[model samples]
Target chain A: MHIEVVANIGEARSDDLLHKTVIVVDVLRATSTIITALANGCKAIVPVETVMKAKEQVQEGDLLGGERYCKKIPGFDFGNSPLEYTREAVQGKRIILTTTNGTRGIQKSMKADHILAGALLNGRACAQAAIALKKDTVILCAGTQDVFSFEDGICAGLILEELTYTLGEKNVLINDFGLAMRGSYLHSKDRLFETLVSCANGKKMSRSGFHDDLILCAKSNIMDQVPIWEHDQMILLPRSLARSTF
Target chain B: MHIEVVANIGEARSDDLLHKTVIVVDVLRATSTIITALANGCKAIVPVETVMKAKEQVQEGDLLGGERYCKKIPGFDFGNSPLEYTREAVQGKRIILTTTNGTRGIQKSMKADHILAGALLNGRACAQAAIALKKDTVILCAGTQDVFSFEDGICAGLILEELTYTLGEKNVLINDFGLAMRGSYLHSKDRLFETLVSCANGKKMSRSGFHDDLILCAKSNIMDQVPIWEHDQMILLPRSLARSTF
Candidate 1:
């Protein structure tokens, strides 16, 4: 199987992603937030690319949660921080989410056969979940603004590493992007925390005194959830319910 | 000083390249051919993205050259091989060229204050030329058909390494794309020939019986030519003439 990774969602074509497994990553911290909300028993996440789109999705049972420039949007229930996704607040509620990059990446991949949200927080599980699908994969990084972001690229590399290492025997193939991300992951693996803190998004968070968000984003393989896209929203299936279609 | 490396030209906006120095690389053939043609004393080369556009630029003194897929077009003077650009035929002649990706990259950066072609052949000279200008630089890799091309990324990385190392005292800053290329270059530097032969483009050229072109492309830093974009064409100025504009 061939794996392609687009550093930006702008490079993705709907036709190419059609019927293929697409994984969207925004490490600090859209995907992290989605997986956290789902793992904590949130009903579903409706990922919209823009704040206006999120506002349009408001309902009595839906919580508006996301960020614009790393700040919680006015009237939103939560920002992009995973720490804000505690069970007490989000349990059994639908979430309408919008962020600078990650949601855009997801909306771009709406044609994907199986769309999943991934991050450094749930990297190993996310990789394994994609591999189990047995379909060609496209890993899209949701960069900050329209430009490439540091933490996201490294997170993409981590997933690529898992996919390549675990499924090497299957003779999986990767293009330049996949190879590039693998190299990025290898280069930054030893100093992931330091690397994240030095990137633009991290500096933005740190400058705004969001040290806890950085620490949470740095923790790897701690969350075993994979937010699978279905019916216009993302919901994590319990491990027992994750076999065919979540 | 700041250096931004767009993984491919598709990600670059014209406004972003406006009044900035742009360096474009297509290591597989287009830029390599341009560098080779200029190094061999060709008067000027016009790089066009499409075959029909190259046909439109035909003139009494200009020779048309380029490729469709790794092979020469039906009625072109020569295919996009550095070997075909030898002094005996192309010396003192203008070459109007079209290729799959590299020319598109050049045309996209037409609004730049200073634009130049770069490749593995003249990597160091190209990087040094950009560094001497002391302007913020954008290294655009002419990836294959809007996708990440392996050799181009490595060539970009080599340029980044040179720029960072030479201007160490100036505190050169690189973003995620820059760091990714640097890592990619370091990963493939030791085995450039092997690396080139294994990439998708390399394999296509090899399968089509262009082993010689692959070897030429794999050889780095042999040519000292820098084809600076001037007046809608690329021409190389001698070392004495290169200080300000080449």
Candidate 2:
């Protein structure tokens, strides 16, 4: 399979993502939060681009969860932190989420046949989901405000490494950016948490009192759940569905 | 020191580059070729954005050197390969050089206080020169046709690593992309030639019968000379001048 790793949402062309599996990665921490919320039994995540749209998407039982400039939106249920997305707070609930970069990335990739939320937390499962879908993939790194972020690139590297491992090196063709990300991931695999802490977003998040979130988002493949976009909402792919494809 | 590593020439902003030392890198093989030609005692290199501009820039006794689509331009004295620029051929001759990416990078960086050509072959020297210039630095990777290339990223990584080594890790503040490039470089430093051979540009160059260029461009710090833009031409920075700043 061929994989194209884009640097950020701004660089991803909607035309290029058509008929391909686009894995939207925002390691710190939009996708990470979505994965955590879904894994904690949230029914689905309605990711919108604007704050007003996020509020409009919400129904009676839906919760508003997102952040702007790393702070929780005023009067929202939660911020963009995986740690805030707990089992008790999010169970069986539909969440209307909007953030600076990640949701925009999801919206930008609306042209893809399949869009999966990927992060270091569920990289392997995401890779498996992509393989099962049987399409060439585009790993779009949701960088901070259109600037390339190290955390997202590292997560892209993780997903690429996982894909390479499952498909064998000869069968997987990666773009130059993907190759660089893979090398970056391999070099920092042993110290992911530390590596994230040193990156631009990580440092900002840490200064904003999101240290726990960083630690949580930096863990690789800790959760088996992979969040796949369906019916305009992100829902966890059933384990049986992924396994049966193999 | 603050360092910003841009992914390609298209991403480099002229406003941000002002008052900074910009290191333009095109490891496979524009910057590498310029460094080779300069080190072979070439008088200077005039980098132009177009073939017509290159032709117009050449004066009496000046040799035209460059490539279009990796092949020597019609009736030009040389191609982009560093091997073709031997001492016997380039010594004391002024070279009007233009290539697909590297020259474009240099032209884009013209707004900077200082512009230096960098590659894996002169990464250390470029870092040293930037330090001596005493300005915030920007390493611009002249990727292939506005897309990121692994070779130039690796060269940026090498320069970042060298900067960190000389300035100490805490003293050097690098952008997120620079950090990723540093990690990628460290991961592949032990087998740079093999790493380059496997990259997108490397494979293309090799297939086009420029395997020797890839091998030569992949070697790190083989030359101590750094090419600096001075009075509209790229000339070797005198060692005395670099040392005097210290």
Model 1: per-residue Cα lDDT over B119-158, one tens digit each: 8878788777886676889999888777778788888888
How much of the real interface does each model capture, measured as fnat? 0.43, 0.96
TM-score of each: 0.86, 0.97
User: What DockQ do you compute for every candidate structure?
Assistant: 0.43, 0.92
> In order, what lDDT does every prediction score?
0.83, 0.91
RMSD of model 1 against the true structure: 3.8
For candidate 2, lDDT tens digit of each residue in B82-195? 899999999999999887688789889888999999999888889999999999999999998999999999999999999999899999999999999999999999999999
For model 1, the superposed segments whose C-alpha errors exceed 4 Å read A40-64, A67-77, A86-100, A240-246, B48-64, B68-77, B87-93, B240-246
For model 2, the local distance difference test gives 0.91
Local lDDT at B144 for model 2: 87
Off by over 4 Å in 2: A244-246, B244-246
Q: How accurate is candidate 1 locally (lDDT)?
A: 0.83
TM-score per model (chain B): 0.94, 0.96
